[model samples]
Target: MAKLALLVATFALAFLVVNASIYRSGHSSCERQIRQEDNLRHCQKYLEEECSDSPYNRPGRYLDSCCQQLENLERECRCEGLQHAVRQQLEEGEWEREEARELFQVAKTILRKCPNFEEPRRCEMQSRRWF
Candidate 1:
């Protein structure tokens, strides 16, 4: 009887630990989503405010360069947001490893296209660290 009780206790503890880990994983996913959302929003705001006003609104070399950079930044932010969403799905056990890996590769591709935007990257990194 004592051994049975010990087994039950051990099982209960293991269950709680697994549950807690899953819960934390989900929470982290949500937090990462929020962070990515905020960064993407900021990038959008910058494009709207800065690029919209630039003479590049027409078609010229300067405008082309600025627009290209702006587009790259926007794409990077968007990819990070997508990665967070994919991670949430992974945490929920709804996504396979291949899908999650593909999504991560997409995000990495986006990140590779642009130089690091320090402040935004820092926020995104911190939020994803919980995983």
Candidate 2:
């Protein structure tokens, strides 16, 4: 009877260990996903800030960096990130309404220049549908 009780206790401990590991693995993965989405948001915000900093100037260097950051995101977010960044910039109220419009146009041009971006298509849709 003692041997049987020991075997049951051992089985319970093994079961708890397996469940604990699985829970930790799943929890970490969930955290990673959240962090990735947060990264995407922050990247877009930074891109807008960068663009706003150098408006009316050549953007060859920093634009590349911003596009690269967005490109690193999941395939779904690359272009959407640009749009979000532009809108976010406008919402920040740093630029006048007319200036915001100009920035939107500039963003469209940047979208065209960025490699792997669909260009013009989504940009036009943004103008028609969004603003």
Candidate 3:
């Protein structure tokens, strides 16, 4: 009986350690997701407020504001997050198909304009749906 109890206790302890590690890793990942979402929101807001209609029409001025918003973000994270965010917006009916397509184009253009921005292949594939 004592040996069985000891075994049970050992299993419980191991289980707890494993659970704690999993929870900690998940929590950190959640935090990172939230941060990326916030950054994407900020970038969208900046584009809406600062960029003129047909920003590609004036690449120089567009680059100034757009690059400022995007420069601080991790390039891969920013691209992936933006693609997800835009897809969510489309799914949620916040944007019409054409609007989402245009937005994706503008985002791609902005990323290209930003110095040292490495365009992620995933973003390209995801955003290519409209094209």
Candidate 4:
């Protein structure tokens, strides 16, 4: 009778151990998912901030670096649908062309304001000259 009682206790302990491990693994996975989601949100917010007053929000140019940053952010995000959509938009050649035009306009504006806007070259998106 005592031996049977010991066997039951042993089985219960083993079951509890296995259950605890599974719970820990699942809990870690949930935490990771939450972190990834947060990262995606942060990246989106950054994109919004960078484009807010820039030519990227206007009709002509695509903020080349901004677009590239979005791509990188998307890659780092690793959340399926969000990453895919961003990748698609950034990769579109037409979209790049539009971005280049907008950037050119922005650079032109900066050059006017600071005559020595030494960084105009960086804003030059060479995808295609709309002129």
Query: What value of lDDT does candidate 1 attain over all alpha carbons?
Result: 0.45
Question: What is the per-residue lDDT of model 4 for residues 1-39, given as tens digits with 9 covering 90 to 100?
Answer: 999999999999999999999988865664455344543
Per-residue accuracy of model 3 over 2-108 as CA lDDT, tens digit each:
99999999999999999999988865664476464464554454344333354444335434544554555555455655565455445544555667676666555
Q: When superposed on Cα atoms, how far off is each prediction in RMSD?
A: 12.2, 10.7, 7.0, 15.1
Question: What lDDT would each prediction earn against the true structure?
Answer: 0.45, 0.59, 0.57, 0.42
Pairs in clash, predicted candidate 4: 60-102, 61-99, 61-101, 61-102, 62-99, 62-100
Query: Is 2 or 3 the stronger prediction by lDDT?
Result: 2
Question: Which parts of model 1 are misplaced by more than 4 Å?
Answer: 39-131
Task: Give the number of the best model, judged by lDDT.
Answer: 2
Candidate 1: residue 42 lDDT (0-100): 34
Which consecutive 10 residues in model 1 have the weakest lDDT in total?
43-52
Is candidate 2 or 4 superior in TM-score? 2
Candidate number with greatest TM-score: 2
Candidate 2 structure quality by residue, lDDT tens digits, 1-131: 99999999999999999999998886565445434655445544444554565665443546666666655655444545556666666666577556666666666555556687663334532744344
- TM-score quality measure for candidate 1: 0.31
**What's each prediction's clash count?**
0, 0, 0, 6
Question: Ranking by TM-score, best first?
Answer: 2, 3, 1, 4
Greater TM-score among 2 and 3 belongs to: 2
Candidate 3, poorest ten consecutive residues by summed lDDT? 50-59
Instruction: Give the lDDT of residue 46 in candidate 4.
Output: 37
